[model samples]
Target chain A: MFLPVSASLRQFARAVTADRLAGDELAGAITAENIRAGKPPAAAKADLFREFILKWREILDANSRPRPFSSAEYVRSLGPPPSEARLVLLLNDICGLSQRDIEYVLDPLSKPFAELLKEGRAVIARQREERKALIVEDEPLIAADLKDVLENMGVTVVGLARTADQGAREALKSAPDIVLADYNLDGQKTGVDAVIAFQDSHQCPVIFITGYPDDVLKGEDVEPDFVIVKPYRPEAVQAAVAHCLDTERFFAIDADSANGDL
Target chain B: MSNEKSSAPEKRVEKLQIMVADSELAMIDDWRFENRAASRSAAIRSLIYLGLELTKSDPDAAAKLLDQLDRA
Candidate 1:
């Protein structure tokens, strides 16, 4: 496969599986299997994605338990589990595949692509409209700025904490849809410590907006998927928040399945 | 004097086959009728061209679509 096509497939698989490792592994396995089978190279982008969808379905079937998958049992507050069609729509947003290409890949779709797109949009809009965020920054100006940006995106700022301890306390008091934390705090505990404190209970997405991205990335305690460096663009923040919110539910589902709690 | 005109040579267009659901076909037919397109091929061509034009104008069309979705 071509480099760009391979990368896009990896991304699409990641969005579908909601686990980076699983998604990458699945993509690699499929590519290797195709090569071993001596199949011709995919003639169109849709062909490659169709192969991925088959592999994903096989995994889902293998992992099927006696009890049917239910989102209510695990996290009722997060709303319903994302349907497969919704995930496809989300994948389109991430991969930027054309409508015709997507239709080809997900042929016999339970719902029309246009209708699914509309429904997915409404769901996302509602989620954003009611979304709440917690900002952990010692700098008063930065915290205020984050609040304003999130508010403009329709995300309510639940609380602002100057220290890790306070951040954790605020998070516990009111659960946030996502958390934006700075690396260094006013107190002994860095933002990493603060995130570690509540992440187990909360399981919300974390975006580290800090000058010391290296320190945060190299930390042994927690590994965040989204990190923005200092002097960030508001557009960057908005994009991160949108992506984090979009994938949070899917991640929760994956976690539940891993723990056999689903 | 002979009248002569110069222009780029026409390129050969290959025929590509695709599968569409019944609903999608109906959508195409509806669009063709509404726009008074000459044929299904014409309607499909116009739609594809429109989509390509939009993408060219705004590479972030998907992101913008998401924003629109949020509003919708």
Candidate 2:
């Protein structure tokens, strides 16, 4: 509830005084006058200060409002999302701010961006209890690490499978909320094959981990919910798992693309 | 202690002086008192800032000016 305009004006005044202030003669006279009036000459800058206030009385009056503006109120003023250029203009003309000031004040509070981020995080966090994951990696060490990461992020790791047949069998038995699969698996079956095998029966989101995702996932019949490229970061895996679990029928490609939706 | 203090970077500061008429000075005093400014120096600084702000061409330019002000 802070008054941004008033605070900015005060800050501006302080900065100007510290740097490029002029009118020394006026300041001297004011000091002399203060001395004659039995006041401390040390506080003699009064007249010069007064001069400044008088010069921009209209600006001061406009900024000195009883209630400071809220981000919600600002969002309401713009209604729908306007072009960035138009928004800049409105902030300057209506709010009496410079473009840089507008960016500092409004960018963090952008309705669409803030709302989408907040909703996404909240949705993912709230649904953590319902999410169960299956880790399908041929490498035992990698599968164990993946399971640890998934479990740390509040996902229940149902099982770990080293081959496509094992992954398909475990997915069917456990009915996992999401699948994390490495591209190359044992028995010459890729992770994409594992996902395709159980995708219809399980109908859960899949996150494909691969060194060569472009080569493996490009020609696939169905895309994954998310893709993590090797060597994977723990945070990246956690984020991908959360995102995939929260979104239903998620594919890495755009929803409008016909091939990605199956 | 002296060495530590001296190791800190020195801030560059400069002094400026300008002339104004008695009538102009009086007007400044009137405005400063009426507006309840913290000090005469504060009033002067505010006026100069406001003057520059008013001259901005449009919102975009004004915003850029503000950015410059922040940097300054």
Regions more than 4 Å wrong, model 1: A1-17, A20-127, A216-221, A248-262, B1-72
lDDT of 2 by residue, A75-161 (tens): 122112222333333233322444445545345444454343444334334436556889999999999999888777777888999
Which residue segments of model 2 deviate by more than 4 Å?
Answer: A1-127, A216-219, A250-262, B1-72
lDDT of 1 by residue, A137-242 (tens): 9999999999988887789999999999899999988899889998778768988888889986776778777676445433133755455667777755665576
For model 2, the docking class works out as incorrect
TM-score of chain A of 2: 0.49
Residue B30's lDDT within candidate 1 is 100
Give residue A76's error in model 2 in angstroms: 23
Measured against the true two-chain complex, the DockQ scores of the candidates, in the order shown, are 0.01, 0.01
Can you give the TM-score per candidate against the true fold?
Answer: 0.44, 0.40
Top lDDT hit: 1
**Number of the top-ranking candidate, with DockQ as the measure:** 2
